[model samples]
Every structure is written in structure tokens, then in C-alpha cells.
Target chain A: MSPDLLLCLLAGLLVGCGVHLLLARSVVRALLGFLLLGNGINLLFVVAAGPRGRPPIVGLGEESQPMADPLPQAMSLTAIVITLAMTGFVLALAHRSWQLSRSDVVEDDPEDARIGLRAIENDMSESDFHGGVDADPRHVDPDEAPPGTVPEEDDGSDPDPDAAPVGSAPGEGAEPGVPGSDDAEAGLDADRPDHVDPDPSTPEPPARRPGQEGAL
Target chain B: MSGEMLHTVLTALVPLPVLLPLVGAGIALVVRTRTRLQRAVSVTTMSLVLVIAITLLWGADTQGRLLVTVGGWLPPQGITLVVDRLAALMVLVAVTVTFAVLLYAIGQGRGAMDRESGGNAPVPIFHPTLLVLLSGVSTTFISGDLFHLYVGFEMLLAASFVLLTLGATIDRVRAGISYVFVSLASSSVFLMALAMIYAATGTVNMAQLSVRLAELEPATALVLQVLLLTGFAVKAAVFPMSGWLPDAYPTAPAPVTAVFAGLLTKVGVYAILRTQTLLFPASPLPDLLLWASLLTMLVGILGAVAQDDIKRLLSFTLVSHIGYMLFGVALASPAGLSASIYYVAHHITIQTTLFLVAGLIERRGGSTSMSRLGGMAAMSPGLAVLFLVPALNLGGIPPFSGFLGKVGLLQAGAEQPTPLVVALLVGSVLTSLLTLYAISRVWSRVFWRPPSVAPMTEDNRLERRYERRFALAPGVVAPTAALVLVGVALTVAAGPLLAVTDRAAAELLRPDGYVALVFGGGEVP
Candidate 1:
């Protein structure tokens, strides 16, 4: 095969294989794919520089064939350096993931799942926006005081959704002072990040919240 | 300096804004152990950059387009750095915001040290990395060639990957992975496009391409245009391409998020604006831009409203608001371009201010979740005011620069008045209203409600809830308030700023003067 044809075939195979790996779930494979793609691009850039000729250096009046362009060589070097830097960072990240989770697979994101569910749940017709409350039976009380109103010093058995220190009525799921500014604006607070205390019934150290898994 | 010498020096000073921060970063890296000296170097470097940026703006406005060829090679043979009105204005805003964020980060760093890790807690490498990021952004702004712009993107992306993973929390590491993959993918596309442009036209010197590209067949030109635009589209986070942004931006520390939110996407817009005007003057896909602007605005705002997190909400709005800039770019008129330019500046200040305010909220309330935070208005009135001002500005309330930019764009859209343009106009108005709705929602939820009232679902979580007035230090509050003042100043000075934007747009639309300056008054042979 001609030099250009061979180069083209090699570049195509690298790119095809790279894209396949890039789509895989495993971090190590994805990283390999990224490297393959970079090499493929470098090859594409070299081939695009057109038919190779004599080394581009010129001496005084020396007879020479057409000199090959050197810009792609420079670009390929730069691209290789960038790829090397990125590869180091990715390897660090992969190593970190393995250390933390004992696997090199990317974790499934709950946030992404929630967002996809939100798109389907939100057609924008409902007056309220939050897709209803969590399926857990314990959180269904409308009469309970809203979260965050009770000072940290106080246990939240009184459940003040409207801790009306000012003019708020004491009970019966207090009315909002500002009409437009209500819990309703945010739609339903369903799936709101709940504060699951050590259950009074079980009395254990508080269970780590799912999202607060990371140490601050 | 003598007048002649001054002109020469000023001609040379065009590259200093890009150089100063790099030098500062290098020096800071060396003295990284000496916290005070590190701060001094970074601060002095950015201050000098700010001064240089102002001088460059004055010089560009008066001196026509100033061009520098690295190592004195002519035209397409060397890397060209040009300081036009647009480049100078962008540099000024970028440095100013970076400086403000630096102040906030330093103060925050000190305060975090005092609070948690006492006595000379290892001064973070934040300053050097931030300066490096600033240098990359400066390079992106002033670069006169497509290849230099790619280098700028890489430098910044590498810096950001480090910044985003500052703490290496599992969440941040996750965000970093997504950020890296998305950025690298776009960068590869950008490189492919650059290679193709070189292959097709034999040049990536944008000014030279301006002359060469016009001669290509329409179909061939269209393919090249699409490729280049796709690369910029990813950077600009236009609509479907913007998914990585909301994911990536919110995971970083507040100041990091603020700087990234402010500078990165706008630089992408700047790239799109510059390349579209220069290389492909009569773009083949204004209709595509129109549809894109429409969808990006609608979808981004909808996504913003659906979220409960403050940083994520602002991130969504940032993506949504880029549509307004694209709207102007799509119209392809002087009025449209000017409006886009003005909006870009306005959005940078507004977005940065809002994100910084989000930082303050997180610091004060211990959470950015609207469901968790409340009573900020009464407890920390200062923080409330800080959030309110930029939030209102972002929502496009009257007398704000946001409102002015929207009106300028709407009027420009009216001038040509195509069906698609009209659709975009309606979308713009709707987006603004929805932005207001979204901002007001945050205000009522986080600021209006007493800290006592929390989300219905969060039961018996008093220990985690912040109980008292947040006693903030003078340092964090001052820089944040300073950025807020910057946003207000934009509104106050809209008249003169709009004039400058108009001049920049005029220069952009008519780039023969620029091309000549870059190419030494010669046509591309």
C-alpha cells in the first residue's frame, strides 16, 4: 500500500477502536480510549500535512526535493504533551476511585437519575413543581413543623414549619406571611434532602446521610 | 517615555496582560511556602495586569488595531497577538474579576485556616494556579490565530482541572472526570477542525483565512464553518452541549466556580464571535444559530427552575443566558453584534457576582440548598443585600445592564425580523421572565423565610441547621461586596459602556483594518 493509504487505514482503526472504548463503563478502558483517540488525531494531522518529502532543513544552495512542512510535527508534539498531562491526571483519578470504592467503574450518579426522572415528571402544567413526597411513610405529616425552624438547641417535636417568632400563628400548618413567596413556589418539596436523626425508637448514632458521604 | 518611544512601548505593552500573570504564577510557585510573599506577588501581578488592560483599552481605542508578531516574523509566519477594542475590554473585565476572586479566596483561605487548622496552615497553591488560569484566559482573549486560541484553552483547562479537584472530595473528583472528558472531547474536535482548516485553506492565521476562505466553494466553506462552530459551541455551552457545565461548575470551591462561571464560557463566546465574523463573515447557519439560541434559552431556564441547589441554579442560568449572546451572533447585524458584546460584559459581572454571593450563602448558612437555607435577610442583612442586588440584575430588572442588553438585542432582532428571529425574540423575553421567576424563588426561599422554617421533608435535623446570625469576616464580605459593586457599576455606566461595545462591534464587522494590521498591510497571496 502507498504510504498515505497505510496511514489512513491505521488512523481509522485507531479512531474506531478508541470511540468504542470511550463509551465503555470502566474507567481504565475509557482512559485507554482517550489515549487512542489522541494518537489517531496526531496521525490524522500528520497525514493531512500531505505527501512526505525530504527533511525540511535547507543548507546554502544545496539541491533538495520539496521539503515537508514542519508545522504538523510541532502540533503533534504539543498534542502529545497535552495528552500525556491529561493521562497522568486521569490515572490519578482512576487510582483514587479504586482506593475509595475498590473498583475502576464509574459510579452511577443518583443526581443524573433524579434529573432524568424530573424531566419526565415535570411537564410544567401543575401549580406545584416538586414531584410529591418521598415514598417513606414517616415523612407524610402535614401538621409537623417544617424542618430548620427549630433551633439546634431545641428538639423538633413541636415541628414548627412556621416558627413564627415574629407574628406567625402557633399551629395548624402556619400560613405564609408573603403571598407569592410560599413553599409552593418551589413546587412540591418532595425528595427534599431529609434530616434523618437517630430514630428516637432505635436510639443509635445518626446514620450518615447519603449525599453527605464526603468528609467536609 | 517620548511620544515615539511611548507609542512603541504601548505597541509592546499589548502582550503584558498575558505575560504578567504568568510571571506572577512562576514567582508565586517559587515562593509558595512564603504565604505573604505569594499573596503579594499574585496581587501585584494582577494589579499590573489590570493597569495594562486599561492602558491597552485606551491605546486600542486611539491607536487603531495594535498587532505584535512573536519574534518579528511577518503575517502568517509568526504567532500574532492583536489588541483591538474587543480584546482589551475582555481583558479588563477578566483581570478585574480574577483579582476580586483572588482577594476573596485569600481571605477565605485565611479564615478557614484560623477556624480549622491553626497556625501557618499550609498556604494553598491556589494563588499560582489561579494566576496561571488568568494567564491562559488573557492569551485566549488577545490571540490573533486559531492555534494560539487552542493553546489558551488547554492551559486554562489544565489549570481548571486542578482547581476543580482542589479538595479531592469524591463529588469534586467525579465532577473533574466529567469536566476533563467533555473539555478534551471538544478540544479534540477543535484540533480536528484546526487541522481541517489548515488543510483546506493552508492557514489558521484567522486574518489570512479571512482573505483565503472567501474563495472556497459554498458547500466546502459550510463544512468548515460547521466544524469550527461545533468546537466553539461546546465551549460556549450552547444548549445540548451545555450539560457538562452545570455538572462541572457547581462542584468546585466557590471562588473557583465564580471565576470559571464568569470567564470560561464567555471566552468561548468570544471565540465564536471572533471566528464567525473574521473567517466566515457570511455564516451559512444563522438559522441554526437562531434555533440554537431559542432552545438553549428555554431549556437552560427550565433546568434552572427544576433545581434546588443555588450553585446549580446559577449555572443553569449562565447557560440559558448565553443564548442571548448567540441571538445577537445569529442576527449578524452591527446592532445585534453590539448588543451581544454589551450583554457578554454585563453577564460576566452579573454571573460572577451571583456565584460569589452563593459562596457567601454557603459560608453563612452551611448549605446552598434553598430548601435548607432561610432567614438570611434578617440574620445577615449584608449577605442578603449582596445576593439581592446581583440576583435582581441577573433577572433583568429595569435599570440593570441585563435589561439594557436584552432591549438592545430585541431591537436588533426587530431590524431584520425574520420568522426565526421573531421566534428567538419571543424566547428571549420569556427567558428573562423565567429568570426573574427563578431568582425570586431563591430570594423568597432562602432570604425571606425565617431560618426557622425549612423544607417539609427535612424532619428533626436541627443539629445540622445553622441556628444563629453568621458572623462573617471583613475580608470575605468586602471582596464579594466589591464584585457586587462592579455589577452595579455596569448598570450605572451603561451609557459609555454601550458606546464602547458599539465601537467594538463596528470594528469586528469591518475587520480589514485588523487584517491589515495583523498581516502588515498585505493581502493574503
Candidate 2:
């Protein structure tokens, strides 16, 4: 077979494998799929460059041979750089995923899952029930409070039980909703005791459940 | 300046908008350790770029498409940059949005220590990468060659990947994965189609292709068009291919998400507008665009209705509204093109403003969920005003630019009188009503009702434990409020903006003008 036909077969096999791997649940596997796909495109660019020839570059005391089409080579190089950067980025992401969820497999997005459930149930209020304490690992730490927010008093627990997708910020849920609440703290502190933290014991500690992909 | 003088000057300045930000990105990266310096560099570069965009818009309107062939080489050989009215207007709005979002990010990043680090979140990457993204966008807007456009897309896509996963949390990483994979897939498809186009035409200059593409077999042209549109549809998030957007967007930092929602899709729309008009004016797929847009509008609005969270709801609406722009594209008349341009300008500002307001709601009201957020109108009247103005505008309330844009598009649709056009008109009206219904539901549940009751209390500040970060700063609210006012100002200045769009539409409908300016004698209007 001609080189073009052979290269086309190679690219096809690569794309096929890449697409198949893309459907896998594992994060690392998906990254591999991305690499394969990127490589296939680069190869196709080369194939599109037509019949190969000598290097396009010129050298001292020698006439340039019938030069290869250099534009596709340039295109291929750029694509490779993009693929490399993406690979590095994806690797970092996989590491982060491993640290957070302690699993390599990509988990279903919590928000997506919530929306799916809402669609199935056809009940908005029922979906709102899932708005309990957002399991975001970031807000569980006590030290995360914005400066001057009274660190000890600030709680990251859910203030509104019925709010779907409750924010994972500290001292949320039961907003005082008083005009100038934060600004008027100096004057309003005496009478603002009504909305103070119901449990001074503190918000729940960071839950580090492992092996389960959704657990964070 | 005289028209000739303006024309000559704009020719010189055509490449600066793309170049300055790139230089700034490099400089900012070099001095990344100095956070304040990096901020200054990014902001200053983008501000200058905004000025250039405005100047180019003035030049394009008074003169014509300003063409610059790089390094003294001419078109069909060297790369060309065409700063037409559509491009100039796009970059001007886009850069302004970028600058405002930068200000918002700067304000939000101040003084507040990261929750995890006990030190500040790394400022080095965000500012520099944002400048890189700006450069990429400017390149895309100004690029005249197809390969150059592809490079621009890659540049932005690379920068956005960094932006999307800035914090490196489980949520962000997950979203980033989907975003990256889909973007890669789209780029791959785009590359393949680009190769095919080059193979068929022997040149990738859009002007040259416009002349050459007409000679190709219709079947070949249709295949190429399908490949290109599929790639662009994924980028623009037109239904079906849009599944990755809402899932990937809401996880990023507010400013990043806002810019992504506002400017990125518009670039895709701009691509569709240009390629469809210039290369394939006698298209084989006008009906495909028409049907696709109708489905896009309906599906997006329906998704918005089902969404409980503000960010996701906005994302869905963003998808829905692209159909309105597509309607303009589908109609393919001067009126349709103008309406699309006007609608695009209206959408960019309003959508970005909405996301910024959502950030504020999350900050002050404790959550962006409608069910959790209530009585906010009483608590913070500032946030209430910020949210309502744009929310009303988004719902196509009267006198706002949104309403004006819709009316312009509807009138354009009415001109065709074809059965397909008639169905699209009805679909647009229905979509607008559904949009109103969805947004009003958010209004009632979020701003009007009494605050939800719960046992525990927490301050609504940026509180992720992964890093030290900027949460609620005094400066954050001001820029966002200013953006809302810009939304209102778009309404106030609707007269002139519409004239400009009408002219842009005229230019788009008459591709000969663009091709002439780029290749035929290069005369000023």
C-alpha cells in the first residue's frame, strides 16, 4: 500500500482506540485517550502534507532538495506542544483527584446527580432537601474565615436546610437578612444575639471518607 | 482625524491589540512574584487594548475593514489581520468585559487570606494567564486567515484550561476534565476540517477560499461545512453539543466563569458568522442552522426552568439565547446579520453582568440557590438592584437593549415570510416567554421571599479550605455594580449601537466589500 494509505490506517486505529478509552471511567485512562487523539490529529496533518520529501531546511554550500511541505510540520509541532501542556495539566488534575477523592475513576458530578434526581422526581422541593450541609471539603476548616469575621463565632454549617446547592461558606445558612447587618455589627451586636450560632460547639470536622469516588 | 489619516493609523495599530497583551503576559509571567506588578501589567495592557478596539471600531465604521499583512508579505501567502466593524466591536466589548472582570478579580483577591494556606492564593498565574487569554481572543477577533484563527483558538483554549482549574479542588478538577476533553475533541475536529479545506483549496486565506470554494463540488463543500460547524457548535454550546458547558462552567471562580460565559461563546458565534457569510454564502445548510437554533432555544430555556442554582440557571439561559443569534445567522439577510450583531453585543454585557451579580448574591445572601436565598431585597438593597436590573434586561423587559435586540431580530424574521421563518419567529417568541417565566421564578424565590430558616449560622464569604483567597472585599461590589450600570447604559445608547450593528450587518451581507478590502486594491471606504 502507498504511505498515505498506511498512515491513514494508523491514524484510524489510533482514533478508534482513543475514542474507546475516552469512554472509560478512570481519569488516567481518559488522559491517555486524549494523548492518543492528539497524536492521531498530528499524524493526519502529516498525511495531508502529501508525498514526503527531503527536509525543507537549507544548509551551507548545498542546494535545498525537493522540500517537504513544511507548513504541516509546523502545524504538527504546535499541536504536539498543545498536547504536551494538556498532558501535564491533566496529570496534575489526576493527582488532585486522587488526593481529594482517593480514587482514579471519575465520579459523577454531585450537581449533575442532583439535577438528574430532580428530573426523575419532578419535585423541586424534594430536590431542595438535598441542600443539606454542602460536603465541600474547603469550608469545613475553621481557619478559612475572612479576616475580622470573628473566627470562633463563624460556622460553615448550612443555615438554610431547604436551599438546594447551599453555599459551602462559613457562617452561612441562617442569614440575618438585616439591613447593613455586617456594617452595623458595632451597633447591632447587642440586639443581634437572636441569630447567633445555634450550636457553639463548632461545625462538623472534615469528613475524609475514602475509596468511594463521591466522598471528599 | 481625517478618514485617510485614521485609515493609515489604524493599519499601523491593527496588530497591537493582540501583541500588547501577549507582551504583557510574558512580562507578567517574568515578574509573577510581584503580584501587584502583574495585576498592573495585565490591567494596563487590557485597558490599552480596549482603546485600540474602540479606535478600530471608529475606523472600521468611518472607513472599512482595516487589513494588515504581516512582515511586508501580502495576502494568500503571509498572514492577514482584518479589523472590520464586527471584529472591532467584538474585541472592544470583549476587552472591556475582560478589564472589568479583572478589576473584580483584583478587588476580590485583596487582603483576604486563603482558607487553607493561611497566606494569600497565588496571584501570579491568574493575571498572566488572563493576559494570555486576552491576547488569544484579540487574535481571534482580528485574524483573517483560517489557520491563524485556529492558532488563536488554541491559544485561548490553553489559557482557559489553566483558568478553569485554578484552585485545583475535586470539583474544579472534575469540571476541568470534562471541559478539557470536550475542547480537545472540538479542536481535533477543527484541525481535521482545516486540513481538508487546505487540501481542497491549496490556500487557507479566507478571502482566497471564498473565491476558490465556489468551484468545488457541492457535496465536498457540504461535508467540509458540516465538519467546521460541528466544531464551532461545540464551542458556541448550541444544544446537543452544549452538554459539557453547564457541567463544566459553574465550578470555576466567579470572574473566570463570567468571562467564559460572556466572551468565549461570542467568539464561536463570530466564527460562524464570518465563515458562513464569506466562504459559503450560498450555503447548503441554512435549514440545518434554522432547526438547530430552534431546538437550542427551547432545550436551553427548559433546562433553565429545571435548574435550582443561579449559576447553572444562567448557564442554561446562555445556551438558550445563542439560538437568538443563530436565528439572525439563519435568516441570512442584512437585517438578520444586524440583529445578530446587536443581539450579540446585548447578550455579552447582560450575561456577564448576571454572573457578577450571582457572585454578589452568593457573597451577601449566603447562597446562590433560589430556595436558600430569600429576603435579600430587604437585607442588601444594593445587591437587589444589581441583580434586578440585568435580570429584568435578560427577561427582555421593555426599553432595555435585550428587548431592542429581540425586536430587531423578530422584525428581521418577519421580513422573510417563509414558513420556516414563521416557525422560527414563533419559536423565538415562545422562548422569550419561557425565559421570562424562568427568570421571574428566580426573582420570586431568591429576592422576594422570606429568607429560609436553618439552625446554624455562617458568614457568606469565599471560604474554600483549599487555598487562601479573596472573598468579600469592598472593591468587589463596586466593579460589579458598574458592570450592571453598563448593562443599563447599553440600553441608553441603543440608538447608535443599533446603527453600528445595521452597518455591520450590511457589510456582512455584502461579502464583496470585505473581500475587496482584503484583496481588491485595499481602498478605504
Which prediction has the highest DockQ against the true structure? Answer: 2
Can you tell me the DockQ of model 2? 0.12
Off by over 4 Å in 2: A1-3, A53-67, A124-216, B1-4, B110-121, B454-473, B520-525
What is candidate 2's TM-score for chain A?
A: 0.55
TM-score of chain A of 1: 0.55
**Please, what is the TM-score per model?**
0.85, 0.84
What is each predicted model's overall lDDT from 0 to 1? Answer: 0.76, 0.75
| Stretches of model 1 off by over 4 angstroms after superposition | A1-3, A60-62, A115-216, B1-3, B110-123, B455-470
Please estimate how well model 2 matches the true structure, expressed as its whole-model Cα lDDT: 0.75
For model 2, how does the per-residue alpha-carbon lDDT over A31-62 read when each residue is reduced to its tens digit?
88878877887787778787767777776233
- List, for all models, the DockQ compared with the true complex: 0.10, 0.12
Tens-digit lDDT track of model 1 for B411-482: 999999888888888999999999999999899778885554333434433323222222354666778889
**Compared to the true structure, candidate 2 yields what TM-score?**
0.84
What fraction of the correct interface contacts does each predicted structure contain? Answer: 0.08, 0.15
